[model samples]
Target: MAEVRTVAIVEDDPIIGASLAQRFAIEGITTQWWRSGEEALAGFARHRPQVVVCDIRLPDLDGESLFGRSTRLLGPVPFLFITAFGDIEQAVRLVRAGA
Candidate 1:
C-alpha cells in the first residue's frame, strides 16, 4: 500500500480548509490549504500532492476549470470536490467530465 504523503485543500472558506488540514495532520499527512483556484494551481505545480480536497466555487476560477488545468499539469491526481451551493446541472457536467 502506498502512503498518502500530501493533500492539497483548495477552499475559500477558512474554517473548512483549516479543519481539513488539521485532520490530515493528525493522520500524519502533510496538507497545503490554498484559498483560491489560482493559488492552488501554483501549489499544484510545485507540490504535486497525492490528493486534492477542493471547494467547487473559488474566488478566481471554478473547481471544474481548476481540475481541467490541473490534470494537464499533473495528470490524474485525485480530487474530492465539495460545494456549499449544490447545482444539479453542474454536478452532472462534472460527472461527465470525469470528476
Candidate 2:
C-alpha cells in the first residue's frame, strides 16, 4: 500500500486544532498539532510533514512568516492557510506574496 501523507497543523485554537487532527487521523494521515508557530518550527525538522495547515494568527508568529521560513527550510511543501472570516482578503494577499 502507498504511504499516507503526513500533515502538520499550526493552530492556536484548541478545539479546531484537535478536531482537524482527529479528522486526519481517522483518514489514516499522520498529523502533528501545534498551538504556536514557534513550537511548530522547532519540531518541523523532525516531523517533516508533507502538508501544513496553519492558522493566520498565531501566538508567536503569523502564519505567512512561518510559511515563508518553512518553504526555505523544507523546499516548498504545500501550505493551507486557515484565516478568520474577516481576514480572508489579507490571507489572499499573503498567498499571492508566496506565503
Q: Please name the candidate that would achieve the greatest TM-score relative to the true structure.
A: 1
Candidates in order have lDDT scores of: 0.90, 0.85
Per-residue CA lDDT of model 1 for 1-99, tens digit only, reads 678999999999988988999999999999999999999999887889998888999999999999899989999888888988859998898778777
Question: What are the runs in model 1 whose C-alpha is more than 4 Å off?
Answer: none
Model 2, 1-99: lDDT tens digits are 546588999999999999999999999898989899889888798889888999988989988789888887888778888877537678678778775
Looking at candidate 1, the ten consecutive residues that score lowest on lDDT are: 90-99
Model 2 global lDDT (CA atoms, 0 to 1): 0.85
Q: Candidate 1 local accuracy as lDDT?
A: 0.90
Question: Candidate 2: worst 10 consecutive residues by lDDT?
Answer: 83-92
- Once model 1 is optimally superposed onto the true structure by TM-score, how far is the C-alpha of residue 14 displaced, in angstroms? 0.7
Q: State candidate 1's TM-score.
A: 0.92
